[model samples]
Target: MLTLICQGSSFALHKMATGLRKGAKLNYKLMNEQGISLDTKDNSDNNDDQVAEDTRKDSVFSPVKSKAQKSNASSAEDDGKHSLPEEVDSDDQEIEKLQRELETLEKDEAKLKKIKQKEELRQKVVRKRDEVKALRDVRRVCIMGDSIIKHLPSIQGVSIFAFPGATIGKLSFLVDSRAVPLADFNFVIIHVGTNNIANGHSLQHMSSDFANLVASIRKFNKDIAIIVSSILPRPVDHSHTKSTVQQFNFHSQDYLASELNFKFIRSYRPFCFRGDIKRFLFAKRDGGLHLNSEGSNRLRFFFLRVISTLT
Candidate 1:
């Protein structure tokens, strides 16, 4: 019985030792698997931290980059609006200068045109002078006055120097200026003073101016026969009445004719019918101021008859 007990104890001790070894191996394997799992979890945590940091960085800088781009665009637009290229600016300045030059040229051209017209008028007056000088008749007659004398035909050996609005005051200047050549003419017929009356000059002033004009004609030649024609009546417009014209004629015949020894022609009688001026004797458009064809013929015949008697 003691031998059997000793064998059984040895077997039990052996089994126990084997069981402890197996438990140690199982614990060691579990520890190794847990260590590997812990390591993988740590690596995943690190990767997640890196990704979040990258996202934060992007969020912070994106608005700043976009603002910088907008600022650049606005600056470019401002440059386009406020400033032009150098070449284009220079061309605009040149165009403005050319427009100014063209305006100046137009003003100069207008002035030149007026000057040319004035020169042409002066040349025409000079040509009239030349024509008058070409006539060399010694027994020449000259009629000088306003438009009434201008209507006188260009008779042989006669010079009619008449201005439309000539007054008695202007007659002396007309004669002195060689407008009426008094040197070669033997007879001078004057029919002015109508314009003087129309211009509101007093009768006394008109008579005085007439006397001075007569004196100027006498100065040219003492032998020259000066005939002072009466002022014709205007039946129309009534600016000058028949009485006023008669008064001026009476003054010329009574005072100037005797004083200056000049002939006074009563030219108003032929146009009068029963102490009134005949309307038919004057032009229809003239308002009874100027003569018609019949009146002009009568005047021409009277002048010829008077001129024939002078020689």
Candidate 2:
């Protein structure tokens, strides 16, 4: 009876060991499915507590996920390393485009400013030209001569510079001494050379002296209009005969009009009748060498006509 009971107890103990071994394997498989790792400890005393804590953490974390999700996450990280963010790239492009546009606007603004300046300058120049034209339209006139012109009536808007027995050679001296303000007048009517002819000057000498006098006056004002009056005919008893005076007048008028660009007035023709001096045209006290009031009035009418055209 004693042997039989001992054998029964041994069989029960073996069955319990087998059941425990199977339970351990089932727990291990469950842990592996949850992605939990179990480290086998050499110390058997804390092994149960360590395994239970690991199992609780794995259940809470739910660590085991799909392989496709993990692969997608890794691919996204790799793409991020190689490429820029869409919003960031777009912002950079927009900034660059704005900068380029600003640069273009600046260039256009600069060009517009330059164009505006040029237009303003052109307008200023045009205004200046107009002012100059208006100023030249109304000219100041001066009549300069010898004793013959000195006896004439005073004219309006005409400055007279007369010296008796004054030759063409002395005219420049008067101008240099500032006795004649050449700058004050635009039109100059000169009646000299008659005295120069009377003083025994040759035609060539008188012409040269007259030209020099005109040139000196022009030097004072380049734009001055010079009108040279012809020497009038004198009586036979005078220093110069009518023929000699006519010859001098012709040569002087031709040279003044053609070469020197001066306007020559033919005042001598009106005072002469058929190559002879008109006694009525001469001053009664001057031996028919100087003009009378009648002659001066007639010459004044001619001078008025000449002056009217200039303005």
Candidate 3:
């Protein structure tokens, strides 16, 4: 009786164990059918949560991302490809583009430097030409006037042409006759109006004669620099002589101021005291008209100073 009872209990325990095993198998199959993974630690709800978190991270950083990074991220999301190698390629392309731009900038800088060098060379050429022209202008000078200009000592580049009793009209005629020789010189000094004043020629007549004389010179050589020396004051022979001489010099200076390439030099200042002519500067033999040795030396000194400025 005890053995039968034990066998019945064993059968009942085996049936219970079998039912539990089948139930466990059924549960596993049902869970798999519902898309729940037992091997991995995630269910459908966890997967959805992880996907939402990843999407949030991408959206939060989208604005700050480079276009290349954003494109790589988009492709990664579309095709499941990794973005690291593509990012490296983008960096290399950017580096190459920057290098090309730098090369272009360097080329532009070199071209600008060459342009500056060319401009500097051109300026040097222009300056050299001007210097040569100035040198040529001071090379040969001709002093033409009455006997007063003849007393000037010989200079290397100077030529003297003097007529003892030359009036303004007489000098003008001589210049017209010798225009060819006068044209060869770069400068002409005229010192002849003393005779015009002494000969009692009216100031209007003298002025007209002087203007015609300059016109004749210019007709021969327009490039020549003409210097006109004022008449020297003589001892007061007549009260009007000194006043007339003063008027002639003032008119000459005023007229020549407007004339191109003409300069008027006052020659009476050194030989005159307060208002009268210095008696020592004139030779008594010529009735205080011609300059003596001391007077000639002083005149030469000032004349040479004027010539120095031109050179």
Q: Please, what are the lDDT tens digits per residue for candidate 1 over residues 200-220?
A: 788889878987898888788
- Candidates 1 and 2, the one with greater TM-score: 2
lDDT of 2 by residue, 1-311 (tens): 88899999998999999999999999999999999877656455488788876666556476764466678888999898767677688999999999999999999999999999999999999999999888766678999888878877777888888888889999867876778998988999998877777777887888788778878888898889898888776663444355567787788666657878888888877777776667787777867767788988877877787888885
- Candidate 3 colliding pairs: none
Residue 20 Cα positional deviation in candidate 3, in Å, after optimal superposition: 99
Show model 1 residue runs off by greater than 4 Å: 1-138, 238-240
Which residues of candidate 2, in runs, are more than 4 Å off?
A: 1-136, 236-240
Report every candidate's CA lDDT: 0.80, 0.81, 0.81
lDDT for position 43 in model 2: 50
Off by over 4 Å in 3: 1-137, 236-239, 259-261
Candidate 1: lDDT over CA atoms?
A: 0.80
TM-score: model 2 vs. ground truth = 0.55
Compose the digit string of candidate 3's lDDT tens values, residues 1-311.
89999999999999999999999999999999998768655577788898877676568655566567789889888664556678889999999999999999999999999999999999999999999888775668888888886677666677878788988888889878983377778888888888787778998898889888898898888888899988888763535588888998888888754653479998778888788778888778978778888888777777777777775
Candidate with top lDDT is 3
Candidate 3 global TM-score: 0.55
